[model samples]
Target: MSNVLNTFLDENLQDLRTQGLYNEIDPVEGANGPIIQVAGKQLINLSSNNYLGLATNDELKKIAQNTIETYGVGAGAVRTINGTLDLHVKLEQTLAKFKGTEAAISYQSGFNCNMAAISAVMDKNDAILSDALNHASIIDGCRLSKAKIIPFAHADMDDLRAKAKQATESGLYNKVMVITDGVFSMDGDIAKLPEIVEIAKEFDLITYVDDAHGSGVTGKGAGTVKHFGLQNEIDFQIGTLSKAIGVVGGYVAGKKNLIDWLKVRSRPFLFSTALPPGDVAAITRAVEIIMESTELHDKLWDNGDYLKKGLIELGFNIGDSETPITPCIIGDEKLTQQFSKRLIEEGVYAKSIVFPTVPKGTGRVRNMPTAAHTKEMLDDALAIYAKVGRELGVIQ
Candidate 1:
């Protein structure tokens, strides 16, 4: 390796270690479910994004296996090439129907979808009014578009309205776009999409929502847009197949014209190989299941309520969470990390999130409660939380 590269890596790593900002990853031994085995020990896992527990569902697994036998492992080429398999076409159609849109375009992953769609639509002549706490991928996509990026306060409607008015009136750009997360992963708060859509109409701005955490967990398993009944109002409804869908891919659902444009111009679709056939087949079945029945979705919410109730009753400051995502706020970064470590020691696997990911001084241990987790598992996790909270003087 080059000496300059070696020095750069060494200095940055040392700085991270000295500041206690370095994260140590624990590899799970088997399937990542309600309970996970890590380093030969079982822990009540609360850190995964597997909201509906479909990742380990027998039916989905069986479907994937069968599809693999029929279609093999890969798509072989980019969608623009010979990779646009029949399964890919079906998945996109299913996604469009699922999102209640005229059409949809699938990508390799949710991150890729953002990178592909945002830049494909907006360009250097446009402007994007983004939420202050929008996901990193949105930020990157905005940057790639080379558009003037203006950030408004997180979930503050007044700020958004004022900014929207200012941007539209400025007359400095040909197009204006507003983008936000349907559910803020860190805070577990649902975006005020109805308000956002209203503002967009007033200012004639295009609206976009990334519902990575909301799909299959909100709106009877449709998504946040449907939850508000604004599916026709929002221009772009982006989602991930890997999260609640229990497969792997990302897609943008919108009007047929918009999807047609994306199909012709999106770089990822033009350059990257399509999602594997088995994964697409599994995702299709998963969406079908979610559309047919809300059983898993209901159980997910029930578990979320149970976990949040226990955490609150135990005197932990679980911030205002409107969804299943829970954040037990512990102010000091070191203390927050220590609290998570103690939880792991007590057989829980919640991870500490700090600066950059969230604001400094608002460090927290985020818990993701999935539908697969039973009442007994939650009880045990709550017990561990209480024990650690007491030992660390975080609770009574």
Candidate 2:
């Protein structure tokens, strides 16, 4: 090993410690949607991203088990090889029908979808216009594309339009693509897809919308593209099976030709192993549930509204969030972590998000109240929040 490696590692660790950004992981032993086991105690969970409360769903579990029995435990090769199983085919077709797209392609995870999709299409001679606050996977994907990434203000379509005009009119590259998250994870705000679609059409920009946070939460379960009623206009609509769908995988829904291109070109798809039979089957079942009933979706929105109202009434600054992802905004990083620790100690399981994830000063405990959370559960969690908030002087 290089002798200088120790110096570099130590310096980085020191910097993180100086900035109060060192992380300590917490282990959750069991889950029952709104509540989970942590540190040998049951706590009301408000930090899980399981929006539909489908992660431990019995129906999904049965479907997954059935698939495993039929197809065995794994797909042993990459999709480009013989690894693409009958279940994978079924999942893709189900996704296409669910999203109302011409076709769909599956990936191991949502992060890989971004990495695969961006690089599969754009390259060094191209330019990409991205939302300033896009997810880390998108950032990495854009860099991998070798495209010159120009960040427009987050959800500011006017700024995006300006950049699109310049990029297209200037004719400076082989292609120009505009990418954004359907729902911003941190602030929990939605993207202006209508405006983005309009700009894309006018400027002939390739449009990509990552719906990881929007897939099951919006569009009555279709996604943000449909929520804005722009399904036909958006070029690439990416979604996660993990968050709202309550499984593990990602997908790209778009025109047949576009998907066909990705199947052959995306490195992750061609290089990585296919998703396990169980995960794909469970996700397929989730799609069926969402398409057939709106009960879970309704309950989720209800819980979100209930939680948001309670938090606001307590006089804590909860940031502007249109979706179920709520953040109790506490400004200092150290204090935010302390608040989260206190919340856990008080029998609530919410996690703190500090600097780098959100802006430097806007540290917060991001609460994710799922549809599985009952009214009584929310009440208990709220009582704990009130007690903790006062004890820590976070609120008056």
Full-model lDDT for every candidate = 0.95, 0.91
**Which parts of model 1 are misplaced by more than 4 Å?**
none
lDDT of 2 by residue, 74-104 (tens): 9989998999988889889999988889999
Candidate 1 RMSD computed on C-alpha atoms after optimal superposition onto the true structure = 0.9
Which candidate comes out best when scored by TM-score? 1
Q: Pick by lDDT: which candidate is best?
A: 1
Clash number by candidate, in order: 0, 0
lDDT minimum window of 10 residues, candidate 1: 15-24
